[model samples]
Target: MNTKDMRDLDDAELADHIKTVRRDLFGLRFQHATGELENTAGLKTGKRDLARALTIAHERGIDTNK
Candidate 1:
């Protein structure tokens, strides 16, 4: 997801989107550990995306529940 897209989201949507990205990252990590993941670059991408979401959440002062 691009920052432009994230910019369009309301605070609630931003929080939800962060949660979704984090979930995807968790799954990706699991797949990587099992040696079942293709596109290893996705792990990096997922981390970056999760970071983007987190930055947005922080900037918006959204209460991210850990």
Candidate 2:
């Protein structure tokens, strides 16, 4: 998702999105480590997506550690 789309989400939605993104990113990392990932670029994309969400969360003062 882009920054504008992410910013449109409310607190609860943003938190949920963050959790989902983290899980997906973790899965990508695991796949890469196991040599089962065909698309390595996904790792970079996932990290960037996560960072964007985290940045937005920080701006909104949303606790995503949950």
For candidate 2, write residues 10-37 as lDDT tens digits. 9999999999999999999999999999
lDDT of 1 by residue, 1-66 (tens): 999899899988898898898899999999999999998999999999888888888888888885
Model 2 regions lying over 4 Å from their true place: none
Candidate maximizing TM-score: 2
TM-score of each: 0.92, 0.97
Task: Record all residue pairs in model 1 with backbone atoms less than 3 Å apart, i.e. clashing.
Answer: none
